[model samples]
Target: MEYILAKYNYWIYILLMMIGLYAMIAKNNLVKKVIGMSIFQTAIIVFYVSIGAKRGASIPIIAHGHGHDVIATAVSAAEYANPLPHVLMLTAIVVSVGTLGVALAVCLAIYRRYNSLEEDEILEQLR
Candidate 1:
């Protein structure tokens, strides 16, 4: 049961990633592509956070009570979630937000020029 639960998290992350990729490829509108990009970014975050979780471990932050948390005392280095992944994820989140902003800005410009958000319509307008 424990093994299954642990693996399930990864499966869910994979499913989310695939769905995001499909949406990105299948959609025609610029806004929908941006939405798919955001979804893809969120799936990556979910994967990172899932890896951070342990079967019985508390959060990495130490509390004042009892010198350190009891759960923290029990884990060895190999079992503990690495802090680097979390830090990298923070950067990924910021980049994703910036990208989303730029995508929206470009989309607005396209809309202003073409008066339609559809990909085919934009292409026609451009030609």
Candidate 2:
């Protein structure tokens, strides 16, 4: 119970991932699938960003010193957490949005061509 409560973010991420996967696999609507993909990507991004966080730690910036031994004392990694994962997640978010836009545009094109946005209906029309 303690572990579950302590790691609640993991549970939330897992739940979101499952919901997205279910929508992508079971939902018949193309738009819904795209939305699911976006949700999944968001969950992954959130997981990465959250995991990168350090408790009681400061940012990655090194503390400036007035003495000559600034590099030795100020660069200790024990007090600061790396911010790369969070930065990478920001890039991932941009890419995900662009991908979602392209996916929705493709769904729109398919709807324009078939006059329907449903997977089953499109397959039936193709048959």
lDDT of each: 0.81, 0.87
- The estimated TM-scores of all candidates read 0.79, 0.83
Lowest summed lDDT across 10 adjacent residues in model 1 is found at: 62-71
RMSD of candidate 1 to the true fold?
4.2
**Tens-digit per-residue lDDT, 1-127, candidate 1:** 8987859978888888988898888899888888988988999998998767666655565444364346465545554556666888989999998999999999999888889889988888778
Q: Which residue pairs overlap in candidate 1's backbone?
A: none
Q: Whole-model lDDT, candidate 1?
A: 0.81
After superposing candidate 2 on the true structure, give the runs of residues whose Cα lies further than 4 Å from its correct spot.
59-78
